[model samples]
Target chain A: MDTNTPLAQTDPVISDEEFSRFCEFFYRKTGILFDTQKKYFAERRITDRMHKLGCATFRNYFAAVRFEASGEEMQHLVNQMTVNETYFFREDYQLKALVDGILPDLAARRNNGKPIRIWSVPCSSGEEPYSLAIYILENWADADRHDIEILASDIDSAILAAAAAGVYGERSLQRLSPDLIRRYFTKQRDRSYRISNDIRDSIDFSRGNVVDPQFMRQFRAVDVIFCRNMLIYFDDQSRRETIEAMYDCMSPGGYICLGHSESMSRISSLFRPRKYADSIVYQKPFE
Target chain B: MALVRRAAAQIAEDQPSGDLVDGQERWVADLASADASIRRRAAHDLSQMPDAVPMLCAHLANERSLSVRSIILTGLIVNKSPAVVTGLLPFLGSEDANLRNGAIEALQHMPDEVAPHVVSMLADEDSDVRIFAVNVLAALPHPMVPEWLLQVVLHDPHVNVCAAAQDALVEAGEPDVIPALEALADRFPGVAFIQFAVDAAIRRIRGG
Candidate 1:
């Protein structure tokens, strides 16, 4: 009731019960799971949202999130809770699995002569699809033997344009070795870098929403998908729908690499979990 | 052979022309197509039609292809209604584990629609059906989930059913449910695992 008190000071603390309740609700709504270790991190965001909405208590904020018909509050909470940072090779272990394990299996299984297609949904600013291209060219021994098509898509058209522009700052290129950087990038005067035109031009970048059946239908016979970290933002039904759409587009025996935190087992039983390199990738069974 | 860029137009050209058709009757008819892929595509498309719910639910029983069955289940989830819940409830008693589990998974996504039926399911005569109901509660996001689990713990005669509810309670339970969980240990005395699970649920609820 102290109006003059700093909002932070007056904000009702999220109790352990409230946190547990919130975590379960959040996890069920969005696939992202927050554990005990993330208690402070989760509380900070919840309180921030509560403050923004002028809700003085966690209970009221949660009620609005749960019962609000428009789901506008839930969307706001999702944006606040998600970390959308992307950089080249953010989780390269899966990339290692791709060139080492996934590609070879696909190559061996291919009897039909067609291009090996890989798709990166929610490609963000192109770090992931670009990373896929670099890794395949540098590592896959059969890269020349197969015509590979790299398709990159994101729901954000602005990000798709940025991905098409193929520029990055020093922070985004931190994981690249100096030699790989020199080989693939032209140093910009502003101290940023632009990826080589060959790499950039070879990737087909487009705007796509993974949950849209119309957009998802455009992709077919995809051999591998790097759909990492994107599904964590979707509600349960959307997540299930997206995964099923991905299943339909992919070639049988094709592989899907989700974020390290994401699990196909939790979403659907369609894919078989396969361990490759240090990471586990889910594979569509050969029909 | 090297890295190549294919235009989205070309990618679209590669798909079968049959898929481009979006007629309701076409898709409904395709649901019975001999080709599993056609059936799957029909199931996927029919998800957008509210009236397709009954047909999609009907297809689940005869759809042998796991992929097609999965799509039908998704269609049912997309069109989730009281009718969808009623359609799926029979699967709780199914002899097919996959169908039963798929129904449970689909039901979990519809908390409001499924909430009305949970109590009756928990009170079902078959212990397996009661356990399956608990399985649905495990991932269900309804606020009443904790109360439902507490009811199962205190009153369900089957230990396996109580155990399933206790496991779900670890995430959904509240401090008030601790008494029932404690009493659960007494209800199933000499069952070492029951005592252990009850203690675990209590610790989790108490935030220890």
Candidate 2:
């Protein structure tokens, strides 16, 4: 057996050229950019799927990901790669800022009596969007008076399904106080908690990606967007393109909240920083 | 492989430390170049320079190129400086397994140098760091592997960490490990996998 020969490559390991080709193909399909730093992680995940599908080589898997009509393999690959480590009220300060400052501003500026729409991109397993709904229902006096819709979306269908199910483990509710948990969740037999119907029903959960230009049109005129922690994984070009698309998706004077580690300043100058009592958020000013 | 080793040794003997430093500095500059290929080539060149070992260790913390980081780890492993082991200690808790495994492989080359650092890493707040430390000790033929493995198996709070330690103990464990496994089984009655791993380690230790 010739170990060095490309024809003899039966093991799951991907060559540098194969990885680079996959990178280009993947980025074009889904606006997520993967640099060299993610090679092993990408290979391991792609190879895992390939083995599951009984594919012998990475090239074969790449072909399936590119040419497959159903797009199931691509979705499986994205689900494996995207990190979804979020908890309820994960960044409480920012949530507090939204409830305290942003909501009132949006309420005062209402024109044509339109309902306030909030979107949570890459909402993970329902934590961020659910947290937003809970905060609004609990804190805002006019939350019931004004028709508010919360749309939570992610590219990974598996996570969207989990979000729609509204059941979460103990780890996902770490920041939620016992009072909140008791009020908002029903205890399951398996020790996990199912979010209350009131909270779950408020969110319109769907599978959508920010990089997909066609899908982002539904989110136009949204008053607030909580796209936290997702942009840190994006490459520079992807970040710029995604942010611009997000900008287009927003209503004038709409607010965008990124993860604490993510910043719009480097990515785009469209959204200006607004300092709240405890947190810094970005706002699209009325032009 | 022998010829390559000899050639590397010959380069180390003949190449001036000053020239190696200049070459390393140029490569480090190239690491930040606009072209990804330039960055990759620089990382490859630096990995071959014996004098560039410490810089390679330091650069691993900042290297964004996945291939470059992997190559730099190979450089650090081949050089086997105590500084390399210590430098890699902080990366054990990295979410990326590639980065964590790179650190582990580098430390495996110089077990004596890594011994003191491993003790501190075992006490790290992150259980993943402790797991990686145990994994390094398991890979090397070090005298400390069995004792540390037993300690982690008995005391680690995280079930996954405990499982990893017991997994390592399956190979390196002594007869004394049997009693420790029995005690661990008692401590975690609910975790069936832990019990299974404990049983596997005990059987291996008893030479059953």
Q: Number of the top candidate by lDDT?
A: 1
Candidate 2, A232: how far from true, in Å?
1.0
Best by TM-score: 1
Clashing pairs counted in every model: 0, 2
**TM per candidate, chain B:** 0.90, 0.77
Docking class of 2: incorrect
- For DockQ, the strongest prediction is 1
Query: B82-101 in candidate 1: lDDT tens per residue?
Result: 98899899999999999999
Ten residues in sequence with the least summed lDDT for candidate 2 chain A: A1-10
lDDT of 2 by residue, A157-230 (tens): 99889998999999999988899999999999999999988777767777777877557645567789998877
TM-score for candidate 1 = 0.87
- Tens-digit lDDT track for model 2 on B15-128? 344533437678889878876445645765776676666676677777765545655664565566676676777778777776777677667657677777766878889877
Cα deviation of A139, candidate 1, in Å: 1.5
Candidate 1, residue B134: CA error in Å?
2.5
At residue A213, what lDDT does model 2 achieve? Answer: 55
Q: DockQ values for all predictions?
A: 0.45, 0.01
